[model samples]
Target: MVEVNQFYLKFEANPDRYTLSDLNFCLNHGESLLLLGPSGCGKSTLTYCLNGLYPRELDGEMRGEIVINGKPATEYRPGEISQQVGVVFQDPETQFCMLTVEDEVAFGLENIGVPHEIMEGKINHVLEMVQLLAFKKSAISSLSGGQKQRLALACILALEPSLLILDEPTANLDPIAKKDVIHTIQSIQEKTNCSLIIIEHQLDGWTELTERCLLLNRKGIIFYDGDIRDAIAFKLDELQEQGIWLPKITQYLLKKRLKTEQKLPLTVKEFEEKPFSLFGNEEVNEGNNLPEAGLPYIKASHISWKVGQQPIIQDISLTLYNGEFIAIVGANGSGKTSFSRILAGIQRPTKGSVSIKDRKLGSWKESQLREEVGYVFQNPEHQFIANTVFDEIAFSLRLKMENEAVVKEKVQAVLETCGLLQLQHEHPYALSQGQKRRLSVAAMIVDDQPFLLLDEPTFGQDASSNAELMGLLQGRYESGATIAMITHDMELIHDFATRVIVLHKGRLVADLAPTELWQLPIEKLHKWQLALPIQVQVQNCLKKEGDYAAQSS
Candidate 1:
């Protein structure tokens, strides 16, 4: 389905620098390969090269050749490339050209000149594949982060391309949403016998599904290309040391440094039954007291919201205690954003009330509420209201009109904290996606809000950037700031969330501790389209337990 011969590229601004260098690789029919790398390492750049977006859309300097099917990528029109290779971009909103889900899915087919009769069948099949069949008529704005992503996948699938490429498709989805997207793609791949290439940070989803793995370093060159399992085990320690996402079980085994010639376990099944089973059942340790809690720092009682004539959030009630990092997760149409806006007071709840420290929503003045609740929108670009990074971070500070010296001090502190002080004078747009997210956060954090609401904060972020963001959030949480995050990263939940709230079909289905959420038997979370976190996942636990004490230690 795809071929590359000495494929390398450099940004126009920097000729000596190659975004992708000396890459020779190919993807055969029906094969699946994962392209792994750090943020700004050109994984996305390489993906664009596959469909001629490198030279045509991005307008970057290119070298060598990338052939699709049997032709060069440079020769194919973007439309012609779409017929053979479909890409679901990292940001679901950017890929959307239509206002409604059904319209968006049909848009691609119409462009391909597929007959209406064939289009309907194809759309329905693709929707069913992504488990979004019931949302055929839903508006794009009504969907949750996960739902929007699923819709993106369905659009690509409707095209029935020979090769499918997804960039961080599960970036901010809950466990349920993650599973649905994976299952949908897997089902489509199996039925159609098409090639799948995924550039993802969440490696667990692709472990069992992919046929091969391609690892990219800072230079944007392919360093490892082979069987998926071998690539994982061979680089297991290195990947983990750098906080890179690998298979959960693989990380678990590597953490223990198990004595084995075999590489780390790449899948749950292998970790369960393997040469490293000498220390079986080693993950869970002796009982440790669960942390106690108190009245939530923020409370919403039977909240409901609507936009235009359609209701987005139904009656919903939830509480977040002081110092708890809470994850509000659900599918695209599950109301995560509506709930967030309501909590942040950006959108008033239609039927219920919200309060901070027992103060009713209406009682708190707009400026007062803004001071207390910091809301970060999902679209980072929308957050940049100022020209330079310095002014953007200082906007909120200036609103207070503190002493000039005090404002400078506050802005500098946040810039240093967000790791963007060096780029303080640069245009926000020139910064990378991760840098943009940090800038948005700096805008919010410098104001010192007590309650922070971040919508999919790590969507397009790489591992290092995500860790930095998490660390920044963690500092605020520890310092008595309340955090309520909406994301699809199951690992984020496992690594940081004290509690998780799941919404399904516009209702809060589960509100429980992260540890307990993992023990639930039903697939309600699955129905919403998410998966378990990499660390606390059952497979990782099983792998740990299977090893001997020494190996497990």
Candidate 2:
């Protein structure tokens, strides 16, 4: 149904820098394709070209043919192409055009000239498919990130497109939300029998839905294309070396040097179908030791925040000590991000007070407060203000009128530290997701703030980049900078956070060490939209099957 022949694409500014080169692929009707690659490898670019966004909506050079539904892409009207090919972007906020969930879904149908009499039925059906019918009247501004994502899908599905393209649809969602989105997609496919193309970082989420795999390299060349099982078993090392994520089960089996003549399992059920004794016991990675932090660096007293009578954060009191590595975790809309903002003074609490180093937060000058408490926003673009990367990291230094020599030296040091030295002259928006994440941290830590608040710092990043970024943060923590981060990556919390703070429905729920948090009942964790790490889940399953030795340390 879709075909690309000798395709090559490059943007206008840098004609020599091709985003995609000599790409060729075909997608038959009702087939699902999984596209995997590192950040900035043109996975998103491919989706754009297929959806008729490249060379039309965007300024770019193209050198080959793209055919959809057996018709040349150029023959379709400007907006007509979207009816056959629907795309859900990485950030659902960008896809929204209407105020409410129902309006957003019907907006697309209206534009496509669908009759008003039938739009309601179509909207209701799609929302029901995504299990969001109850939220049909919810305001778009009030929906959680996960809900927004489902609404985005509902909007696209309402169009009854022949093919669906989703670009990291679950990147911003919490654990349970991720499962919900994946299950919804599976259900849609089973009922509608539509073609699907997914560009994702989490391989485990797509394993069941994936039939074929397409691997791209740094230069956008298709290095491997084959059955999903073959790709996982034969191309694992090469893919990992190129920064593509592999399933946790695959990683574990490879670590144990176990050989399986049978098909490689993608799900836990498949793994467990074999003899339970075939799996080896692996210890869970206990997190780093808690630092002997000194007196309180930040103290929140009965803090509460609300928006138009809706309490986002309740009366919460806590003390964050200097040099402690802390992680705040909870479901979407549970107020984790709101609480972080309150501590950073980005949001004022509706009630109660906050102090830093024994001084009231309100007493400090704006300039001093900014320097003492650095905040990295959840969306990196929200905090980016400069055009070029070098200028961005050096913006704070320049505000103080530092000499050019000193400014250059400091900016260069940070660029090298974050592995962005080569892209020093590049535009901030042009960097890859992983590079942008690193740049965000580099910009904030350049001032060496005593207290740092980072929200989902590892989002859209690969394993290597995640480690490098965490190492940089660890160095700063060792130097006495108290760090508070909001994340849903349980692996990160298990391995790095000295303390884990749990929040539920705008209230503080648990404050405990990493091990203590893991020991909580599974149902309790699920209530907060959290989950045990992959290793922990496997260990627990093994224990239940009469393999106590397989229990995690």
Candidate 3:
């Protein structure tokens, strides 16, 4: 369905640098390919080329040739390739052009000049495939992040393209929603027999659907390409070094060096089917040890926020102590972002009060409040203001009129910590999504605020970058900074969160230690749409084996 021969590309902005170098790959009809690579490794850039957006719509120079559906890519007129290939971007909101769900789907069909008589049927069918039929009339603004993503998929599917590309479609979705979206794609591919290309960092959900894998190195060159099982079994170490995320089961098994009777298991079912045994009695700790509470930093009392008549945050009360690493987790649209915003004083509460160190939030001057609290928005671009990456981080320090030497020193240290020292001269907007996310975080952390609130700080990061960023945050926490993170990654919650706060329907439902949160009834966890971390899942699997052995004895 698609073929590339010695493809190379370089953007006009950086004429001397090649974004993609000597890429060669092909996709057969009805085949599914999983594209894995480190963040900012030209994965997304390659996607643009595949969909005929590069060298035409985007300002870039290209070499070699691309053949799609038996025609050279250059031969296709503007917007013609879209009929054969459809791409759903990482940010779903960017692709939306209509107000309502049905309208959005219809707009794509209308652009393609689909018969008006069959447009409604096509829209309804695709919506049904994505399980968004019931939300057909709903406004796009009302849909949750997951629902919006599904709607974006529906829009692309409505055009009936032969090759579908999904770019991190579930990166922002909660556990349950992520599962739902993945299953929906799997079902649609099964029914349509269309070729698929998935670019994502999260590998656990895609392992079952993808037959082959294409791995890319940081230099935009292909590192490995072959059967998914072979890559995981033979090239595990190489993949890890490249910062690619392996399937959860595979990661656990390889990390523990467990003995499996069969080949490396890529999915949970495969792990359960294969007899595996630990090398020794190595018990894994399911949670972190809770630290002693420090002095109060910020306290919220019966705070509530609303938009028009709808409540976004219900009368929630909580106290954040110095040096606390708290995680706010819940389903999409559960008000995690709203509560964090309220705490950061970015948004005023509709009712009740918030105090920082015994002072009401309203009483603090704007500059004082900003110095006291640093907020990182979920969309990194929203927080960026400076032209260059260095200027962005230095903006905070420069505002205080610090000495040039001191500003440069602080900025250099932060850029090094965020792994963005090389891109100091690059425009903040020109960086990749992951790089942008890191820059936003670096800009906020350079000043070392007493309290930090980050909304999905690790949303687009690769495995290595995620660990490094988290380690940086951990260092800050250890230095008496209070950290509250809003996230959908349960694994992150298990690994770093000292306290877990569960929110549901704009209300705080459960606040407990990390260990206690993991001990909740399965039904309760499901009610809140939460999933167990891989460590906990592996622990349960071993516990079940122990129980079976005891029964046999």
C-alpha local distance difference test of each model: 0.78, 0.84, 0.88
Question: Backbone collision count in every prediction?
Answer: 30, 0, 0
lDDT of 3 by residue, 476-552 (tens): 98888999999988888998999999999899999988788888898898778798887887777778888897899
Best by lDDT: 3
- What shift in Å separates residue 431 of candidate 2 from its native position after superposition? 3.1
* Cα lDDT tens digits for candidate 2, 1-553: 8998999998876677898999889998989998888777888888878888876876768989999999988788888889899999877888898899999998898898999888888999989977789878878987766678788988998887899999888877888888888898888878878899998887777888886888898888999988878876787788778877777666656656777677666777677767766664455454555666578889999999988878889989999997788999998878988899889888899999999998988899999999899999877888999999999999999997999899999999889878789889889898876678889989999998998899988887765567678898989987878889999888788777888889999999998888788788989999999988766666766767664444653
lDDT of 2 at 65: 92
- TM-scores vs. true structure, each candidate: 0.87, 0.93, 0.96
Error of 3 at 204 (Å): 0.8
Please report, as a residue range, the 10-residue window in candidate 2 with the lowest summed lDDT: 280-289
lDDT of 1 at 5: 93
Q: lDDT rank, highest first?
A: 3, 2, 1
Q: Residue 98 in model 1: shift from native, Å?
A: 2.4
User: Taking the tens digit of each residue's C-alpha lDDT, what string does model 1 give over 80-172?
Assistant: 888898898877898899988789999988887899877888888888877788888888877766678788888988888899999888766
- Taking all chains together, the TM-score of candidate 1 against the true structure is 0.87
Residue 377 lDDT in candidate 1:
91
Model 1: how far is 295 from its true place, Å? 5.8
Off by over 4 Å in 3: 115-118, 128-145, 259-262, 278-281
